[model samples]
Target chain A: QQQVKQSPQSLIVQKGGISIINCAYENTAFDYFPWYQQFPGKGPALLIAIRPDVSEKKEGRFTISFNKSAKQFSLHIMDSQPGDSATYFCAARGAFGNEKLTFGTGTRLTIIP
Target chain B: DAGITQSPRHKVTETGTPVTLRCHQTENHRYMYWYRQDPGHGLRLIHYSYGVKDTDKGEVSDGYSVSRSKTEDFLLTLESATSSQTSVYFCAISRTSGGQETQYFGPGTRLLVL
Candidate 1:
């Protein structure tokens, strides 16, 4: 079973527009929610992450809005640029020393200029 | 950027053959993980190690094995290559088991089984 589910397998947004991706989780034990960005032929890099205690966290133009009550979270990129085109993955990790991460299928984001 | 490097970045082998991929890190992290990435599957963990000579299986560990002899090296071995095992493998390192610590990933090693 996929503990974390992501929506919109692929997305396209115009430059300077906002890009959003959503993810939902079934396991309440998860406390850490992180998003990773992967470029072609490279490894996934940490983008932004939020803990259950915080409802939102922002890093530069990337923001993560998390709703613990709803068991859902979303990533918002302000003023999306062509350089933002890449694959994004949402992951959840349990608090009980479970180093393993449960990842969403993935979302291929494209910013059209 | 995390000082992680993967060896044999690309490998092509035949079925029934054995293959091994290596991951080296200079960050001296405590946790190391091996994950595979496919088209439909985002990234599935095959195995992980928390310390030297300690290892555990992950979500997908059927045909794979791993070893960590030192803090800087983690190796993933395929007992016998299979067509279904063809995928891109990645290695990740983290300073701690859980919390706000983020895992840093290596470039990746692409393997093909014929």
Candidate 2:
């Protein structure tokens, strides 16, 4: 079973626009939700993350809106830039010390200048 | 940039051959993981280690075995490699703290089995 599901296998956004990617989870046991950005031929890096306790988190132009009850969360990139174009993934972990991470299929985001 | 490194960045092998992939970390993180990434399917965990010699199988453990004799290194071995195992393998590490499940991934190893 896929514990987490992500929508829009690919996305296109105009520069300076807001690009949004959504993800949903089926496991209520998951408490840590994180987003990762991966470029071609490179490893994924942590973009942002949120916990069940927070409704939203913002760091500069990146934001994570988390809805615990709905078991859904999203990543919003404000003022999107071509540099932000890459494959984004959402992941969930049960809790502390959970060695396994349930990852969404992935979303390839493209920013057109 | 989690101080994680994977060796044999690219390899081509034949079916029924034995292959091993190695992951080494410099951060001394307590947790290490191995996953395979396919075209349509997302990354699937094959095995993980929490400490030296402490390992467990993940969702896709078939045809794969892992060993962590030292905290800094984790090895994934394919007893008999198959074409079905052709994919990119990634290694990740995370710290053990309060909801601190942020994982740092290493550059993947691309394997092609004929």
Q: Every model's DockQ, to 2 decimals?
A: 0.70, 0.73
- Each candidate structure's count of clashing pairs: 0, 0
> Candidate 2 on A1-99: residue-level lDDT in tens?
988999889999999999999999999999788899999998888888888999999999999999988999999999999999999999998776554
Please identify model 1 stretches exceeding 4 Å from their true place.
Answer: A96-98, B96-99
Docking class of 2: medium
lDDT of 1 at A87: 99
By lDDT, the best candidate is 1
Model 2 alpha-carbon miss at residue A42, Å: 0.8
lDDT tens readout by residue for model 2, B14-75: 99999999999998988899999986677899999989999999999999999999999999
Candidate 1 DockQ, CA atoms: 0.70
Colliding residue pairs in candidate 1: none
Which of the numbered candidates is closest to the native, going by highest DockQ? 2
CA displacement after TM-score superposition, residue A51 of candidate 1 (Å):
0.3
DockQ for model 2 equals: 0.73
Error of 1 at A37 (Å): 0.4
> What part of the reference interface contacts, as a 0 to 1 fraction, does candidate 1 reproduce?
0.66
